[model samples]
Target: MTPVVELSGVHWGPKRQADILHDLTFSVAAGEVLAICGANGAGKSSLLRLLYRHQAPRKGTVRLMGRDLWLMKAPEAARIVAAVLQEQPTDFALTTRQIVALGRLPHRKGFGPGTLDNAVVEAALRRMDLTAFADRPFGTLSGGERQRVMVARALAQEPQVIVLDEPTNHLDIRHQLELLALLRGLGLTVITTLHDLTLAADFADRVLVLHQGRIIADAPPSQALTEATIARAFNVTARVDRSGPAPRFSFQLHG
Candidate 1:
């Protein structure tokens, strides 16, 4: 089967022509969940931006499905890959429903919203359990609620691949698990950047560890979260155990 997303020797950075992602190559298969974990400045967010075409690579190429990302128009690319970026400001005074409805812009022919578009937006809001808050201003919602609304907006886009940056940032433990479970149920290609190693282990089919802008480890969480790999990339000693439904990790503080 053809992979849904593929990056070949991709290199990108904002300035100085220094490659934050150095010849990074990876492919995400359809219906698979791949979590990216790394320390600060490890270039995880930069990688996501490159994949979603928010920024073009300085070298190499990024492909969505079989099409070259650079060749695709911005609206066309948005239709194929939906993203939930970290701490994106909602300075606009839009309602939750209005915010979610904007996801259909890629499919809209003119400035007006259509019935089919509104139906998809409503459905997405309901799916994310935000139906009651549909009419409320987006700025009024709590952080976790706002995060769910953001995910709902992404869902409304009906994209084949979802790229999330720190999706669980403001979510409570229960909501965090729920959101991951929901993503797994969708069975779309998922690429998420997560700081929580234990959550990554529980939710991801595979984990990719980045260090200093290079992919240091790519394997199942059981193998990827080994003491050595965790220590090397995160600079923290972790104890991995298979006692639960999935492998879990506990960090050991070091001086």
Candidate 2:
């Protein structure tokens, strides 16, 4: 089967700065959930930007559905991939419903939103369990609530691929699990940065570990998240207990 997202020899950095990411190569199969794991400044978010077109690579190519991502027009790419980054419109006075309706912009023809667009937005709201908060002002919601609104907006785009950067950052434990569960059922190519090793193991089909902008491990969670890899990438001693149905990681500083 053809991969949905592919990156080859990709390198990126702010102009004149050393590359934030090195020659990275990987491919995510259709309907796979990929979790990017790394410490702070490990370039997880920069890698995601390549996938979603927030920034093009300084070298190599990022391909979506077998075509070069940069070759496509903005709206054309938006129709395939949706991104929920840390940036939020907290100052915007738009309601929750209005926030999600913005996802339809790539599909919208004229000015007014159409019946199909409204239906898509409504479905996205319902899917994210934001129906009750639909009419509420976006700025009034809590951090977790706002995060869900962003995900709802991404869903409203009806994207084939969804990229989220630190998606569980603001959620409480219960909501984090709930949102991850919801992602598993989306039937889309899901890529997200996750700090929680346990959650990353449980939520993703594969795990990609980055350190100093280089991919050290890219494989199934079972293989990608071993004791040595975790310790090497994170600079901490780690052990995995696999006696249970799932792999559990315990960490400690190297003495």
Candidate 3:
């Protein structure tokens, strides 16, 4: 079976001088949740940009649903992959519903909003618990609320794959669990970059650790997030305890 997403020998960099991602190869099966974990400047965000086609890899191919991502039209790709990145676009004057309704742009048949489109937006609002705030201006919302709104927009897109860059950013503990749980329940192919190793271990079926532009570890979290791997990737002394669903860690900064 064809992988839902695949990258082979992918190398990417904004300039010709330095590569942010080097020879990165991975495949995500349909309906699997894969979390990418790494410290800062490990090219986590760059890899996501490749997946979403925001930036093309300087070398190698990114395939989606067995087709070349670059070969697909913008609307065609938009229908298959929806993303929630860390930075949001300016929506000062737009309401929550309006911001989410933009997700339907790929599916729009005519100029104005349709009944079905409106319904999808409504459903997304409810799913993200923004129904009461649907009419409120997006700029007025709290950071967590805005993050949820971004997710609602992605949900509204109804894509086969969801890519999130730090999906837990700005969310409180309760909402973090709620959002991660919601992602798991969706049954869609998910690829997210998370700084919290514990959250990655707890929520993801598989974890891939990136370091200095390469994948250092790729396996089930229990195997991938070992004490050795943690120390090497993070440059910190740490212990990994496998007593629960996710491996717990105790850390000491290296001197």
Q: Report the alpha-carbon TM-score of model 3 versus the true structure.
A: 0.98
Off by over 4 Å in 3: none
Instruction: Report the C-alpha lDDT of model 3 over 153-173, residue by residue, as the tens digit.
Output: 999999999999998999999
Clashing residue pairs found in predicted model 2: none
Q: Mind giving the per-residue lDDT tens digits that candidate 2 earns over 1-255?
A: 779999999999999998999999999989999999999999998899888888999999999999999999999899999999999976568999999999999998888999999999999999999999999999899999999999999999999999999999899999999999999999999999999999999999999999999999999999999999999999999999999999889999999
lDDT of each: 0.90, 0.95, 0.93
RMSD in angstroms, all models? 1.3, 0.9, 1.0
Better of 1 and 2 by lDDT: 2
Whose lDDT is greatest here?
Answer: 2
| TM-scores of all candidate predictions against the true structure | 0.96, 0.98, 0.98
With candidate 2 superimposed using the best TM-score fit, by how many Å does residue 72's alpha carbon deviate from the native?
0.5
lDDT of 3 at 22: 95
Candidate 2's TM-score reads: 0.98
Superposed model 1: Cα runs more than 4 Å off: 253-255
| lDDT score of residue 61 within candidate 1 | 86
TM-score computed on alpha carbons, candidate 1: 0.96
